[model samples]
Target: MVRFSYEGSSERNLKMIITFDLVNTSNSDGRTSLQDESRSGRPNTANNDWNTARVDELIKVDRRVKRKEISLKLDILKTNIYESVYDKLGYRKVSARWVPKMSDEHKRQRVEISQILLHRCQQEGDETVE
Candidate 1:
């Protein structure tokens, strides 16, 4: 079927490419798309999966590891490491330590604690609670 599909040195190469493209295409049952595939602009070099994994490991090893420390250890830019830690790892700085962003449970606990503080302030007076 790929014999005359495209001008290729071998039909095998064209068949493989066509099959790959078909697999990538969504909802295209039997139609061959001539349009060029959309590209995901300039690739991220440092902020890729491999670096993100390394960044995660470093954070796990030391909760208080600074961005500069990671940058030096991984030999990557601090800015790129910052993106991996914050964006990919879902972590944030708290009291000079890197901590994972609060989960739903933590958020619920915070609400309960706030309610308790508010109740104490109302019953025992704000000055006493403070």
Candidate 2:
């Protein structure tokens, strides 16, 4: 059957969109809408398998290595996956470090590197090598 549906809104300016949700009800089994019903029991979570595996690898490595290495591995995994390691494991890998905090030594080293860079910038302004 042919049906015409019109929807519009007026704010600041004005806009209108005419949506044609055409329905062939004669062969639709008495259905009038165009949406299909979803199946019950948990949605598909297949895409997260890689992250889950990475989390497992991290856990296994945690028993044999330091936390910093695990943190770096987690960063690599995130760079490659672009998603939360914990969320991807069907909430199973809760121990995965999504954002590992920098250690005091790491922070100190970063500060020293920044200071050295600043000194270099100041020196470049003060002298020219011939």
Candidate 3:
């Protein structure tokens, strides 16, 4: 056992010693470690596949839907609902409302349309657009 001390620790002067579990932990694959084992992180209690699909469908129906509204309607925590929309469903707020990330095809079409407008402006001048 080895005593480890931190002079600047603010946790009410907490101190500890090296334990056998940390020094000789043989993981199932036969690895010893002093670090925490891998974990799946926070549980996806509400932001699982089902909620993700629901969030997608809801956004499709109403782009102006708020996170709080989704939380109330789906009875899910706001944080989890937010994760489903932003992280899983790939949505971001634009003009105070969520907008789905554009697909590659949609982006290409937008670029093509912008190019056409640019060409028209060069030929006809900016005043002619209005």
TM-score of each: 0.52, 0.25, 0.59
Error of 1 at 76 (Å): 1.4
Top lDDT model: 1
Give the worst 10-residue stretch by lDDT in candidate 3.
16-25
Task: Give one clash count per candidate, in the order shown.
Answer: 0, 0, 0
* lDDT tens readout by residue for model 1, 32-102: 66567778888669988998999999989999999999999999998898789988899999998888998
Residue 52 displacement (Å), model 2: 13
Over 4 Å off, model 3:
1-43
lDDT of 2 at 57: 69
**Per-residue lDDT of 56 in model 3:** 84
In terms of TM-score, which candidate is stronger, 1 or 3? 3
lDDT of 2 by residue, 33-129 (tens): 6687677998645335665586556655553444356447655433333343334432222344334445689899999999987788778964533
The predicted structure with the larger lDDT, 1 or 3, is: 1
Q: Where does the lowest 10-residue lDDT sum fall in candidate 1? A: 15-24
Name the runs in model 2 displaced over 4 angstroms.
Answer: 1-97, 126-130
- Clash-forming residue pairs, model 1: none
Error of 1 at 56 (Å): 1.3
